[model samples]
Target: MQTQPISTIAFTVFLLLFSPPRAAAVRPPPNPLRSSCAQARYPVLCFQTLSNFSNPTAKPLDLAQAAVRASLVRTRALSAYLGTLKAASQGFGPRQRIAVSDCVQQISDSVSELSKTLNELQHLRDGTFQWQMSNVQTWTSTALTNGDTCISGFNAAATTGNVKLELKQRVTDVAMLTSNALYLINRLADSVTGKSRSNSGN
Candidate 1:
């Protein structure tokens, strides 16, 4: 075998020493929206509702905001539907009319509360995060309660009809969406605050 020249050997050694190692293929991070929604009670609903938004790779705060906005959209749609039904049922019997009117009002209130929650969430910051999150939580809870109240109004008045049942179901569905949004918001708040404290500790 022929031996390489000294210069060649030195060059080979230099190449070996300075050559970059083969990089392992890195897996992309899991979809944050899917990961976060997986923690919700209504994971499918949470995912479907929020996935419609523009960004899926958003941070926790952004995801929470998106979820709240989606919830608001749902609540507003439900409120509008209730309003139409209430208007059409103007000549309905006293009990039915009263029930429908109450439902409209309750769903409207829920929409308002959800809108407020969204507003609060939009302004959340690391410094006043906890308090702001608390307000968001309270508003979301109230929105959920309002939805339940809307359904209860129909039940209390013993209102029955295809329209009544449909409205109740729709309101319940919106309320469930709100509930899932609230869960995501709480989780995001905890995650962000915990990470902030951890970084501070270091």
Candidate 2:
């Protein structure tokens, strides 16, 4: 029996069978505003050595540092729940608003302390500032003030998605400010060290 010539339809079928499957769609990059944040360069200075927050005798630096860390914890907590809240379209009333506002107040107080730390850190330019480490006192005060401002701003905001979005934006700003304060503070301290070394050689 003579073999039938391959038909066009058969050829088309064969080609389709050999073709590779399409790849999954690639995701777009995240929005820049949300993606960017403070460089994770941790601060390495003790404002004041205190046992704990319960001890009112602790130095402001220690107290302030504790406060910032606490605020960050709250941030994490809220971030975790925010997704669920948004998904359910859950509407928080005045009480929740007040709670968030309290958080904002805490942030503001922390920022104030950080700013003060920057100013005091600048004084680290002096060798004498090495001892007592008291120069950073003013800086601690400044940081506390800014921290308070940050917290207060959030608390004062209206209870709306728009307001919440604004609060999120402020978080980024606070992170950036914290990074800057730490960087400048270190630089100021370095300047003092260089001066000390120079004077010793003279």
Candidate 3:
């Protein structure tokens, strides 16, 4: 009998199905702002707009403007990453083929969820910083999966194409965006909660 090789993936999938989803430890929120961050987002285009004619390192006039810039930064990085993935899937070696296919699956899944979260982010900016937080968490996991896929693809192929190299670069870009998004989410939350405390004290 030609039995299938034991795969960590099969085992992991089985374990996930059986085990309970673990929850993160709850923490107090930050941000002293009265308005919510749910609708806060970076620009749909790049960070620059008629309202943002100068350097982004300089202060944005309002919270929404700051958010639009942040979202654009994240979006540009994500677009760059996808470009890399398209490039990496170019080879035909048995190993390379397998590796690239795995990356494609993960990248596809991650992007699908990312799109959903982004749509939600664009809708409102009230008490929904939780959505922003969720986007970060999802992206972090996606990056890990994409990274593993990239390494595996590289190992299987003797030589990489421009495309393959791009995939690796994308993993880098996505990780950067994930980290920055989380920092903003935390800071914004803290500011919100701090303001709430102050008003209560007053």
Candidate 4:
């Protein structure tokens, strides 16, 4: 007979002595929002943002819309903040002022794009699902691109370091939300298309 190591036997005894009941060790029930958010590029942010409105009955399209709405809300708030910065830009260097102004415009554009995406998602029709989903994809992608543009505008050497850092962090947050929205939208489109194909086959 093989002899077990003392440490191994001791560890086994420790487990038996201290481990919780089997029921307590069982995995917790799955969260639908967590499951849905896993499909996004930023799953943690996605879950956090959607948790405010997510329900047990929320479907893929519902989650996508909620994500876009969250992005839109954040973008709009950032746009307002940028407006204040642009107004108080007298203290900034000429290049910094220009960068701030441009960032404001870029964020404004992002707001518009996200608004369109949310609208399209809300009114999605099965008859034109593909066409409408294409529009949503384009708009969401544009929104993300606009945020990137805003961040790039601050890359000039003349930009105020603190302002640049703050704007970058805010824009990055909105961009992550938008990116997660796009991921969910794309997943919704793929799932619908797959089902259509399966139905046709049957």
Q: RMSDs, each prediction?
A: 6.5, 17.5, 23.3, 7.1
Q: Please, what are the lDDT tens digits per residue for candidate 4 over residues 5-92?
A: 9999999999999988676457878998998887678999888888985775699888888888889999999999999999998988
Instruction: Output the number of the lDDT-best candidate.
Output: 4
Candidate 1: deviation at residue 170, Å? Answer: 1.3
lDDT of 3: 0.51
C-alpha RMSD between model 2 and the true structure: 17.5
| Model with the higher TM-score, candidate 1 or 3 | 1
Per-prediction TM-score:
0.80, 0.37, 0.47, 0.85
- Candidate 2 stretches greater than 4 Å from native: 1-91, 118-127, 131-160
Model 1 Cα lDDT, one tens digit per residue, 1-202: 9988999999999999999999999999887677878879899888887788637768777777888888888889988898888879976788888988888888888888888888887776767988888888998999889888877878888877788778877887888888888898888878987888899999
lDDT digits (tens) for residues 33-133 of candidate 2 = 11211222432222211122215443333333443444344444444444344344336665555546455445545545554443443333334676524
State in Å the error of residue 130, model 1.
1.3
Cα error, residue 114 of model 2, in Å, equals: 4.5
Clashes of each: 0, 34, 27, 0
Clashing residue pairs, candidate 4?
none
- Would you give me the overall lDDT of model 4? 0.88
- TM value for model 3: 0.47
Question: How accurate locally is residue 26 in candidate 1, as Cα lDDT from 0 to 100?
Answer: 100
- lDDT against the true structure, each candidate: 0.84, 0.46, 0.51, 0.88
